[model samples]
Target: MTPSTTHAQHPVGSGFTPASTVDDVLEGIDLTGKNVIITGGHSGLGLVATRALAKAGARVTIGSRDTDRAEQAVSGIGDVEVRQLDLLQPDSIDAFVARYLDSGRPLHILINNAGFPGLGGIVRDARGYEAQFAANHLGHFQLTLGLYPALRAAGGARVVTTTSGAQRVSDILWDDPHFTTGRYDPGLAYPQSKTANVLFTVELDRRWAADGIRAYAPHPGIVPATAFNRSVGEEAQRAMGLIDASGEPVIDPDRGKKTPEQGAATIVFAATSPLLADIGGVYLNNSDISPLDEDPRPVDLTDPDTEVPVDVVPHSIDPRSARRLWELSERLIKSPSA
Candidate 1:
């Protein structure tokens, strides 16, 4: 069957809700003999996904900047291995891909789950590209392209990139994505990278679906226990209603707040759901495809009552923009320093 060309950003009634856990998504699904690699699979939502996928009978490999820490974190998980992968470094990405391909394993799933929240003030990589853009988007871009052989060899594969609702807040800063001209704000930079993720997914699926490789960008919702949220400090978390006055996490999946297991549901769904076999190049949220919502709204993080929009926006899924970003990313990765 041919893949669908339409980028329909609407729910398919996945039968899973925002509160669904990883086990819920993996229910009645068997991944035995499947080979999967997940970036940052040893921590937070990634870790939860790793455990769930591994439990489903897949041989899982985790790519982490800190192999020692990743190993310790996944020590209890069976059928899982950890490898060194620093997304900030091109050589590290290449090395990780090389080692995986050398094993001659057909990769059934590749989850680009590692990300830089861009909490610290503007940071740049060796290529002088914005750290968040470089690590979160370009690094995964290079990694996925490098693993093309294995993915194609699998005959059927899925690439799930961990995006966020933040994609709604900003489009790609096409003029100066690296923030080379204006003052760099982590707030803007992080969302720009996230938008790039969705764009990358759109273009990837369009290009590779013929080869039986599909792509997905899933918003895991607001997982407060993640290192990204924890770094914001307790006071700020409280102000955002991520936590209470007593420092307890607020589990409200409807408003995007969720536990780690709940947050990983959509990601796992994107990777394994049979319902999505014919669908590609769509943004997912709450364990299902999100409907397009271009409604403009302020992203006031301080306002706990404000429900942040998690739906797909036109700019992020625009074919022209997606193609443009793919070309731009190609140039960026081919630069003399890159």
Candidate 2:
């Protein structure tokens, strides 16, 4: 099946708004006794998501590569637990999932929220995969497949991956997923991983939705000042016009170009909102079904779906490509029925 070009469709009065905060999206939606896991939940939009989910009475577990940073990220969030799981490290993913499953607690929500930004220089993982691709797409791919049994056990569980407007840049370079053959263009590489993110959701949803497991990709919007910017140097930040002449970040660390609270609304809505029960395997932004225009120009400032047009266009979500991508991705990840 092809991915759906339509934005994540929900009822007319789902009570979610463009400016809705995570808390607002979850208002009156109880998550008591639920088990939710958010990667990179220790900081940025993930932290806000953790706070909202926990406050709604769910047991929120955060997966972070750095235990200390993860602990620090959820310090003020109530009843939050942190675990060690770096998406780039396959062994770490396995170990963490083994431990979590050992607890016999079913996983209700798996938010593939952790991601690394583009490091301008050509970098490789231990496996020699491109850093941006490895950390952003492949790592999450491995983690999701590793946790498939747990997700299935949870039944009705949802897996929401954090994709971006950058995905519109290009499709997966199937011949060179590692970027060994071509020049490593940071702009293009980052968008490729994002596109992979959306594709993963599309494929995952198609494969697992019948079992009551659903998948979604969300553009959390442009969040600045998070660790995601660590690889994005000061010069690049300045180049993007995100900094001031004094060299200070124009926005506060807690605040992004958008508020952290507002940035997390879409993910929160996807996780618990009843409005989306019928909508899965789609890309969403600002709590609406985004429209895509094929001929957006440079600096057109279109919706997330239109921003990265390399792989998925307004009409890109068709049955053929969605299923084809699913098969290809499963083969690449060596996932069983991914």
State which candidate has the highest lDDT.
1
lDDT of 1 by residue, 1-338 (tens): 11133567879998898899999999999999999999999999999999999999999999999999999999989799999999989999999999999999999999999988777688889889999999999999999999999999999999999999888878899888998889987778999999999999999999999999999999999999888888889988888888988888999998899999999999999999999999999999999999887565667766668887788887889898999999999989889343
What C-alpha lDDT, on a 0 to 100 scale, does residue 70 get in candidate 2? 82
Give residue 74's error in model 2 in angstroms: 1.3
Instruction: After superposing candidate 1 on the true structure, give the runs of residues whose Cα lies further than 4 Å from its correct spot.
Output: 1-6, 299-303, 336-338
Q: Report how far residue 204 has shifted in candidate 2, in Å.
A: 0.9
Question: Model 2, 1-338: lDDT tens per residue?
Answer: 22233444333455555567887788789888899988998888888899999999999999998899789767877778999988777788889889888889888899999888666587877766778887887778878887888888887899999887776667667677677878777767887788788777877888899878888787776655555753477877666545666666554322224467877888888788787787788777765444454454464433322332222354334445556666665575553222
For residue 107, give model 2's deviation from the true position in Å: 1.2
TM-score of each: 0.96, 0.85
Model 2, residue 160: distance off in Å is 0.3
What TM-score would you give candidate 2 relative to the actual structure? 0.85
Question: lDDT at 118 for candidate 2?
Answer: 60
Q: What is the lDDT of residue 231 in candidate 1?
A: 87
Number of clashing pairs per prediction, in order: 0, 8
Query: Which 10 residues in a row give candidate 1 its minimum summed lDDT?
Result: 1-10
RMSD, one per candidate, in order: 2.6, 4.4
Which lDDT value does model 1 have at 2? 13
